[model samples]
Target: MTRCRLCGSTALTSVVDLGATPPCESFLAEDQLDLPEPAYPLHLRVCADCWLAQLPPLIAPEETFREYAYFSSYSTSWVEHARTFVEGAVERLGLGADAFVVEVASNDGYLLRHVVDRGIRCLGVEPSVNVGAVAREAGVPTLTAFLSPETGAAVRGEHGPADLVVANNVYAHIPDVTGFTRGLRALVADDGWVSVEVQHLLTLIEENQYDTIYHEHFQYYTVASAARALASGGLTLVDVELLPTHGGSLRLWARPEGAAGEPTARVAEVLDREKAAGLQELSGYTEFSARVAKVRRDLLRFLVEAAERGETVVGYGAPGKGNTLLNHCGIRPDLLAYTVDRNPYKHGRYTPGTRIPILPPERIAADRPDYVLVLPWNLRTELVEQLSFVHEWGGRLVFPIPELSIVEVTS
Candidate 1:
């Protein structure tokens, strides 16, 4: 029996099936055109015991993130987001020369750059070789290995326990959830705080964000489920904040039980809201699958209509979520033409399942396609501003999630 990753519950129900799909960032080369892509079961399940939403087991972390393709510094908005997060966290924690900060899965030192700038000692534990090299170039000392109980203990032995341990958007990606949390407990000092940012399950269902379900994201979290998971490893949630990044996310602050800091009203309020919404009930899982089906049908119909009208459609932002959405919808190059990405690594490669070629953003301006499908719909505002010149050709930007809407630009 496949037990729940969090609560060890054997009672689980399937929620949504995204079918077999390649890892979102598994871009292909021209020589690899004929190679069969490795597709895994993209099924989500809810733990009846703890109510944690999660994907079925598939690719291991070593296979998925050992040579990560994503670079956090590619997006201008994301860079600003990291900067703001660092500034706020440092101020909130009163971190200075005496404090040491450790960040897990710190891709390219995006957030740690600010910590180092403040003259505070910081260490980054990143598994991806290429990304860790970038972090090293940025002057952030990064260890190239997965963060687990053993690695965490080694880190603590060398650098001592951290005052602040930041793990932004890494909680959902870990498959061995129990071992990972235990690693956090081993690394965090008695009074230190471990802050984790994860895409909120409540927001994922409410916003119809099924595209976030790829092989790398092993677990989806609600504040209640997160608290339960942490408590199992001897930690307690002290505070929680709802963030707007990646559609919607939650920043959870945790520490050892009875160490310091009391659970904030926000934590209790969020947990209460999740319980009232039936997150812990089986009915919630059944309803979520139906909602996802509606989204698939709606998106397909919109793309078909556009194709019939001879509207030149192209995709913006070759993000992982975009890959999942396109692959699930069975969209290919005939409909999307090509996708634009700011990351150099993704450029000149083809998206996994669809095989849509990825090019630089300049292609959009040059081609001036009639319809630009904004794949990374979460960055609509920033993308619209950057590609506003498409208005010169009377082109419109199409957003295809939650609903399909075309926004016309007025110059």
Candidate 2:
């Protein structure tokens, strides 16, 4: 058995078993659909010593992010979230034209674009060449490389330390978070701050977010686990904020050691909340597998009933999480006729494992699917409003996780 990634403990416990699944973001083009694809086990386990839920590193980073399909600017609410965060950070950090900013995994310069517009010197370190090209085109200086201690040192030597290092939804994608956080410390100025956003593990267990589990996301973190990783990287937590994005995420602020960051009360408050909710205990994760199993059964039952009634069912998004859910639940194109997306890149392609046909959102109105499973349930409000025309035929919205729920929509 493999030891825990954060702490080398042989005492690893299973949390949720997602079975074998393909790379969630690896959408197949029409020409590539006939090719054989690889799959990996998607089970999650928690360390008895550190309580960090994790998956083994079967897929290398090079294959996962070389030319990624995910583009941050595609989501409206997400773009708004990034803009609001930049505004807040600029105000709180007192950033100006002289301040230098660095963003790790900065996809398409969605947030750094705001910083550049403010005249603050900004740079982005992106691993995906395809995504980095888009950022470079947007006038955001981007380096097509992964963040590491060596890479961090090189950037610091040439460009000097940064006042702010932004990491949003990138930590989970990384296998060596200890090394990644160390790179964040190596690149930031002595008095500068490192802000990281990760999907909260508490939300995963509570909201039945099994869909979020994939090979790319190697680790799941609670505040306790995250603080441990950051501390290992020579940083100290100063503040933590809960976000509604990505089901629920935690935005943690940290500073270099001996810099006197004086953590906010929210730090202890959230820790206490996690302890109160049993997140700090191994037993808390034991019941989660059963909770996730219930969801799989329920979703399968819903799809089967819909098909038996001679109703059409389709999906709304092609997010990585959606692929995990569909593959885990054994959903096929037979039950779900096809899925639609607003991103033209995903059009004319098929989901990784489920192989559900991908089409434009216009297909939803033309076919008028009786049930539209909102694949990205976290963005249900935005998708529902955008797809309000579905109400013309009394089309219903389905949320499979957090207990299968059917919602009625009005135009």
Candidate 3:
């Protein structure tokens, strides 16, 4: 933390301090509830040299991912998103049966299954043993190991150089950004394409999506800074696409420096947008802490008022981001009652710090709470339809990010 993780610079400035919270995905079992829990400083800082927004590497990847609780297949919309990405990648990269594809941190084979269907050889390098087992059971060729320069080289040697390397929603998870990017280089063919999807810092600040900040995500990247990180591993940013997933994300296309020609116009366009948003300078970040404070205040006020009015407020989706929001707001079972999730693994567990009980999604219908707080608000569209049954009991849904808003479901 003394030096920037990306640039090794000591000139790091505070972005926002979210106090301290437990690791976002560390759900506690019933027996462990009475034991002491651990928390870390959830403060975010920006590197003055590289403009990369990041948190200190308080927790190691091995501590969190070895036996992960998150299963990507639980989210129907995310599964569909993976399917679409595979189809597009096949077409965009002219991949065929001869093509070799690799996905880093491929959870539960949610994405590479599509590659398998198309007869393209694919491999998933995942760090989590439990989730990697599920991927192997589902027929994905998975290696239960974390991605690193050595791991990547071993994969390339054993499986042959990959034609396409896909890393989705994992670019920000590693504390060693430069090393991880080098791993990507080692796995991919000299002329092969590398695609990475990460939450865009610009949208994170503009949309008031501070809840996404957690220990798991070591760094947040704008295209400008991302390009610099990619260069450290000899990868050149070729094209950029703005994606709607993970609130707002960037799909960066990169290649080995020798094969990467000039970057696409879209890359310049996105960089211009980032600069215009004041991200390259300190101006854009100056007011983010105040806005984040306002969000916390507004959400706490609503929950407090709901309690006073004798209205029941429960949460939906025990996602990692939801844990950050709940812990930061200091919400416990008293204010939230209990939350429901589609993931069976979390049904009987409690959220890490807040200790909110996680029940099956059907519990909402069985108990019919007055308000269902939508924690994974990024999946709002898909969840609304899934929870439309709330309309039967005149129940409404609540969203806390991008400002708090409530919507009454109609049958």
Candidate 4:
């Protein structure tokens, strides 16, 4: 029996099967489209002991993120979100010029740049050479190395332990949660705070967000599973805030054991909600595979019927979630002609497996696709506003996850 990554339990249950999917971020150059792209099994499992829904390691971090293509600065809303976090963190944590801040997986210094502007000392540890260079260019003092206990200790030796450690949207991507959390303890001061943001498992299940599952995302966490992972690595969960990001994400604030503060009611309240939602039991995860299958079938039917009606469909964002939905349903250029992304790094590249071309968002205004499938549904409100001009041509927008909904727009 394979051991669970969180609890080391051999008792695991299947959650959802996405078949084989290529690494979502592996966009191809024009000349490389003919080359064979590798796909790996995307079988997700939930640990019976800890109820952590996880995808077993299918690809290595070096293959997926070392030369990462995704850049955080491409999205305005996401950058604003990071700034909001930094502003609140500064006020709440009493961060000032003397305070030191460190961020793990700080893509392009999107969040840490705000801290630097305040004259606070900050550093970013990013493994991806592509984006790490961007962070350094932005004067955020980024290190091109993965964040492990060794790296954390070395960084701490050079510059004293950080007063604030930020690890946002990283918990899901890292394969070794145990080692990472332990490294987090080493990175922060005993009296300092560490904040980790991860998409909640409850949201993934209830919202039919199976599209969020991909090779890079190794695990999904409920509040309970997350607490357990942190506890094992010498940290104590002090507070949790449920934020309306990435469908829904929980920002967990933890502290080293010796410096652990009083627990907040928010922690218990969220855990109770998860239990009431049946996430504490193994049975909660068993029914998700059926929901996932329905989503795939429904999306395929919609795309197929739209094609028959001579309605053209195109995609909006080149997000990781979109890649999962595309490959799992086997959607190709026939269904979605091409996708538009705000990121120049992804523009001109072809999506892995499906081989759909990626272009800039500016292309949407010129082409005027009949139905624009919004792949990053979490940003539907923002995307809808930005692409509202499509209404002039009587075009509609399609949302596939949670359910298939066709939204018509008027100019």
Candidate 5:
């Protein structure tokens, strides 16, 4: 943390300090609940030199990813998003049966399963053994290993160079940006395309999405910083697309420097937007800490008032972002009661640090709480439709991000 992870500079400015919290995904089992739990610093800082917003690499990737609790297939919209991305990639890249696609950190083969259906050869390089096994079970060929320079070279040597390397929602997970980018270079063909999707820092700041900040996410990237990260491994960003997934994200298209032509005008357009939003300067981040504080205050006010009024408030979705929100707000089982999730893996566990019990999705309907706090607010539209039945018992849904609002659902 002394020097920027992306750039070796000491000029780092504080973006926001979220105090300390356990790894968002570290759900505790009932047996381990009595034991002491550990928490790490959740502060995010921006490098004045490179402008990459980052946290210190307090936890290693293996600690989080080796036996990950998150399964991408649980989210209906995310699965569809992956399917759409695969179809578009096939058409956009002119990929056919001969084409080879490799996805890094390919959790549960969410995206590559579509590639498999199309008869395009694909492989998922995933670190988590449990989730990778699920991918293999689904008939998506997966290799259980972390993406390093050697790992990428080995994959390339065994299966030949990849025609397309898709890395979605993982660019920010790795602590060593330079080494991870080089691993990407080693896997992709010289002229092949590399697509990376990461949460956009501009939207994160503007939308008051501080809950997304956690130890698992080592860094946050704007287009300017992302382009620099891509260049470190000799990849040139050729195009950029703004995506709605994960609140707001950037879909960056890159390739080897030799094959990468001039970047699309969209790249410049987003860069201009980032500059306007003060992401490249200090002004944009100045009010962020205050705004984040306001969110924490507003949420706490609602929860405490609801408790006083004898109204039950429970949470929905035990996502990593939800853990961050819960821990940062200092919410325990008393305020939240319990949260329900679609993922069976988290059904009987407790959220890290906050110790909120995670029950099955059906628990929400069985108990019929007064208010269901939607933690994974990024999937707002999809979750709204899924939880529409809440209107049955006059139950309402709550969204915390982009400001706290309680929605009256019409079934």
Candidate 6:
């Protein structure tokens, strides 16, 4: 029986099957073409008791993120998001110079830089060696290891419990849900709070964002599921806030049970909203597979049509979501000439599974492809503004998911 990760209940049902897929960030090298590609079952299941949407068991964290290619400092929007988060957190938590802040999965110290600038002692826990090196260079005291119960104990012994623990967009990537949350419980000071940010599962299903179904994202969270997960580790969900970043996300505030202020009405409001939206029921995910299948078909048809017309069709963004979409839709060099990314680390590599080369944004301007498919559709507005020059050649931007549509510039 595949028990719920949060409640350990044996009552679970298969909700959506995305088939086998490689790790989205496993970009390949030209010389490594002969290496056998590994693809695992990308099936999602819903826990009846906890309502936590999650993929079936597969790859371990070491295999998934040891040499992670993604660096948070590469994206301007993400950097801005981090800056805003730091400002809000410092003010809301009433943090001062003497208080210590710690962030898990702090890629390139994107968020902690602001914390450090405030004269607050800070630490970052990052598993990826390459990315950790970058964070170290930024003057952030980074521990190059995964966040586990043992690590938490060790960190507490050395630095004492943290006043604030920030885990942005890392909650979903952890496979050992129980151990991870326990680690949070051990590391947070009695009066401290831990804020976890994750892409909302409700938003993912409603927006047809099946492309976010990569191997690394093991669990999809709603307020109820997250509450249950934290409570299991002796933490309480005190508050929840919705954010527009990453399409849609939830910032959950948690603290040790009986440690702080009472749970706010906002927490109940989000839970009630999720339940009303059928997030707690298994039938809520029944239509998700069909919706995603339709997306796959539509995207494939559009790319095939563009190819037959001899029009150059390229992709934008090398995000994990983009890799999932490309691989699922069978996109390759024959269909997409190349993909453009602003990140220097990803520029010269080939996308996993599809093997489409990743080039700099300059390639988009130089090629002026007839169609530039925006893979990270969530960033459409920002990307379109930056690449508006494509309109100079009568080229248009295409969004594949939530339906395929092309946008034309008037000016």
Candidate 1's C-alpha runs over 4 A off are none
Q: What lDDT score goes with residue 263 in model 5?
A: 94
Model 2: per-residue Cα lDDT over 298-389, one tens digit each: 99999999999999999998999999999998899989999998888899999998889999988888888899999999997798788778
lDDT of 3 by residue, 311-374 (tens): 9999999999999899888999889999999889998999999999999988898999999999
| lDDT minimum window of 10 residues, candidate 6 | 402-411
- lDDT by candidate, in order shown: 0.88, 0.91, 0.94, 0.91, 0.95, 0.87
What TM-score quantifies how close candidate 3 is to the native fold?
Answer: 0.99
User: What's the lDDT for candidate 5?
Assistant: 0.95
Tens digits of lDDT, candidate 6, 1-411: 378777788888887787788889888887767789888888888888878888866888898778988888877788898999999998998999899999999989999998888899999999999999999999999999899889988999999999999989999998788899989888899888999999999888888888888889989999888888888777899999998877789999999897957889998898888888888887687888888889989888888898999999998899999988888888889999999888888878899888899999898888889999998898877777877888899999999867788998534
Poorest 10 consecutive residues of model 3 by lDDT?
Answer: 402-411
lDDT of 1 by residue, 202-315 (tens): 888888889988888999999988988888777899999999988999999999887846789998899887877778788666787777788778878877888899988888
TM-score of each: 0.97, 0.98, 0.99, 0.98, 0.99, 0.97
lDDT of 3 at 246: 86
Candidate 4 yields a Cα-based lDDT of 0.91
Q: Cα deviation in Å at residue 266, candidate 1? A: 0.5
Candidate 5 residue lDDT tens string, 1-411: 799988899999999999999999999999999999999999999999889999999999989999999999998899999999998999999998899999999999988999999999999999999999999999999999999999999999999999999999999999999999999999999999999999999999999999999998999999999999999988999999999998999999999999999999999999999999998888879899999999999999999999999999999999999988998899988889999998999989999998889999898889989999999999999989999999999999999999999999987
Query: Global lDDT for candidate 1?
Result: 0.88
Give candidates' CA RMSD values in order: 1.2, 1.0, 0.7, 1.1, 0.6, 1.3
